[model samples]
Target: MKRYLFLLVVGLLFFNFGNSQAYYFPERNSNWATKVEASNSFNQIALEEAVRFAKDNEYSGSRDLRIAILKGFEREPFHKILGPTKKRGGPAGMILKNGYLVTSWGDTKRVDMTFSVTKSFLSTMAGLAEDQGLIKDIDDRVGDYIWDGTFDGEHNSKITWEHLLQQNSAWSGELWGGKDWADRPPREGGVHDWKFERPKEPGTVMEYNDVRVNVLAYSLTHVWRKPMPIVLKEHIMDKIGASTTWRWHGYNHAWTEIDGIKMKSVTGGGHSGAGLFISAEDMARFGMLFLNDGKWKEDQLISKEWIQKAIKPSKPNVNYGYMWWLNKKGNRHWEGLSENIYYAAGFGGNFIVIDQENDLVVVTRWLEPNKIAEFMGLVNDAID
Candidate 1:
């Protein structure tokens, strides 16, 4: 009996030890820890090659982002820089392995515009609202909460939180002087035809429209009853030990009254201009929070369930999730990379790739947008 009891206790001890995590978390306002010898986990030559590849293939756009925005989107009708834009720095990025800095290049601390990577952050806001029960169900009609004319129409009323997050709400209309149909209009159609066309049923198709994205931001603002920036700062950024330099912005005319006080609604991308302006390091930290399944050290800032839902493939687009881009086999899938990989991508080549299986978080800025797949392939090659 004594011998049998000893074996049982020993087995239990081994099981508990095996389940314990062995990752690191950087403290607030301090330098992140780095791998003492990166060679131990990564092939030094391959890793160096990845960094060099990123630096060599810088985005070929005007560093003055205002010019870049206007010129880049010139194909779209009535596209204009409607919000604030900043001159961007050269290529900068960081790679974290098991929460330790593995390698970095360029000015990791330089704050720059992150463009549509803001969408992932905005999606987190919805996750927070759901976690707090502010949104009882994502499937619940958004009109049920806002009640404002923003969601009054038959088509618009069908938009649920999930549909908005998935970019498939097909919520037609205009906001902040931008018409929904004018954004990335059909390549073949004229303005009149595009405007008069019927919008697809919510959840049936995915359309990447800035006006629809802003509608989501506006609705979320009403749901949170305060500035979305404040909610992000208080709930996620501060808790994750992000820097004070990061800022979220909306269009110049994007103000609305909330609780008797006027507040500016934030945008999900920098397509027309302002979204998230942040440093590469801060972005990596945010990536790390998701890398560990929404847990930061001892605190679970966002629930694991929400994180799971955020990364799952949506029906309309296998390559998209709740604002996060999945690497599932699809149009945007990176060849030779794990299908489980997910990332947040923005214009001007900003990306935050989360490879949970390998315990990696890679944040790159100003890389050539098309070069990401090749760069990630090289990065993945480094992990021996």
Candidate 2:
């Protein structure tokens, strides 16, 4: 009886201990430790803790977050693949934009919603349209096309493409839904009832609005006379050859907001938060393409001059550009970031940070939500 009791106690202890340890999300051969140099600053313990937290919540680290680490090591090598055979974590594959350090993180095959990172991709598309004379200028008024009654008035009609890019349009419509994504109308009289009337003036203030961007997408489609997705494929994705796949959620049916309000049903246009989907490494590849003056493997995907213009701070906001946000602090807009470090940030801490001086692109995704800035701070400290 004592022996049986002893075994029972031991088993209980083991169970408790096992419960105490955070669950770890497993990836095949994810022993990146063998690849990282001793001199590198990444805290392996911290990363492990993060992974465990992700797993404990069934957060889908790769499914939701497309994070990977790479370096030029002699002993260990990297792998590449596209989407998953099963419910995989990340993308199908990635491309080597530039050598050992230039390689992208592929193989894990995680694919999830990449939210606002879509805007950065869209900015490149706009740049291409500009370069090809498909669009006149960023400063052009949105009222010229899409005779939507929204921008038809005198004050509202002055809203420019640049205003939309910078989030300076000041068009006060519905912003974000907080609770149930399915209950509210997407827009008023759109496909549903959640339609936007009008806000204040153009380029007068800065308020983050996703529906405004949808309008930009519509404008692009109207001018190009082709689906925005096709334009993105031909101009940006294919040009870079990044070996990744993505889809736009569509203007009317992509998402159900946390507030139960669906934006697609309202405006018949997809908003910023629900439109984009891509892999973390692919995102890094895209960021690097920008970092290298919009060149990819000896091909100039975007004009260097245009890339510079895109990154530069805007007149009104000082921290946002055409679908791109600038990292400015000391100068203005409270960006509170170093000049060299810029990021493509998305909902739930999805980020692709580009360090121009360091020649590095750090991609991270956290299913945990709201902890991205903290993790990014840690990554920043490690790399610096």
Candidate 3:
């Protein structure tokens, strides 16, 4: 009888521990829990001060953020910088610990172009395609499905989905009226000399070129057999319970036809214009979903294996993953944050930082770029 009672007690302890480990997802109504209820490990005052500090730093962005990027980067013609854009909010963010809102700042409802953070969403779509067998092998030459001249030519044909995902595809091309050299020209060279520089082998050099990223976007469109936004709405955004206010816009001139149907090819960044315009709440949901290893209430939205590979930094750039930014080597960027942390960062100071170990998801928009580290450090210090 004593042995049996001891085993029964052990079983009860394990059951309670498992129950404590489960997450408490927040609903859409106003009943979301407070910081105290959401987290027992973090100091509430520290969290509040962190948010207050972030809110106080809201005005650090260029007074006019709409064309601030243009003022910073003079590569593209001002007229060509077109598509969809929005004036940013002050500082905005949603903090989640164990899937509950710990704190939030600014206007979570404001929808603005998230810039290159769109690359992470684009990568998610590619992941969804791979998960559903739409993409047989990431190593397969992209030229196989995309018969268009986009992936043709000797060097270009050697490029694969992995190469593009890693930003090393060196697939030479001008798409959406943006040339490779013109996208991100050298900082210290004459335009004439930069444009004439010889191209390198595919998968050799890692260049953050939107033209190449757009080509990858266009290639995925053919494989999925539909517009990417539609695919995302059906498969990801809708599943995560995102709001209807979000949008993913492509350039008006970037239309491509497949199977007698024509659609606009999306971009991986809001460079010239148009990218992901989503609410902070929605982006928080995205980070939370990823924090749970691509699962949403037992539904494996994406494979765990793919996510593992997605977060794993590429060979050339340990600081970058499929489309995510990793803090590899512990000092790649975030000083006080853990090396295990990764994020989706964008221009105009947008971020979706995920720290699975702490069960934290932080979404910030329109904050000062330089102050992000300090803000994140403050948040981390709050945790017990």
- Choose the strongest candidate by TM-score: 1
Q: Which scores higher on lDDT, 1 or 2?
A: 1
TM-score of each predicted structure versus truth: 0.94, 0.63, 0.92
- Rank ordering of all candidates by lDDT, starting from the highest: 1, 3, 2
Count residue pairs with overlapping backbones in model 1. 0
* Candidate 1 per-residue lDDT over residues 22-92, each given as its tens digit: 56788888988875633367888999999999999999999999999999888788899889999999999
Model 2: residue 174 alpha-carbon error in angstroms: 9.2
Which residue runs of candidate 2 sit more than 4 Å off their true CA positions? 1-108, 147-150, 172-198, 253-274, 330-337, 367-370
Per-residue accuracy of model 2 over 1-384 as CA lDDT, tens digit each: 999999999888556423412111112223221112322324545544434443343333343222321111111211111122212353222211121232223342356666667777767767887888876787788777656464766666788878877767764432232211122223335422232334556777665555566556656666666666677777777666545466655633323332343333212112222356666645655776776777766678788877777887777777676667666763332233366566666544456666665444556654444454444454344441
Quote model 1's TM-score: 0.94
* Model 1 regions more than 4 Å off: 1-20, 37-39
Q: lDDT, candidate 3, residue 32?
A: 50
Kindly list the per-residue Cα lDDT of model 3 for residues 42-77, writing each as its tens digit: 798898889988887774556455577676566553
lDDT of 3: 0.82
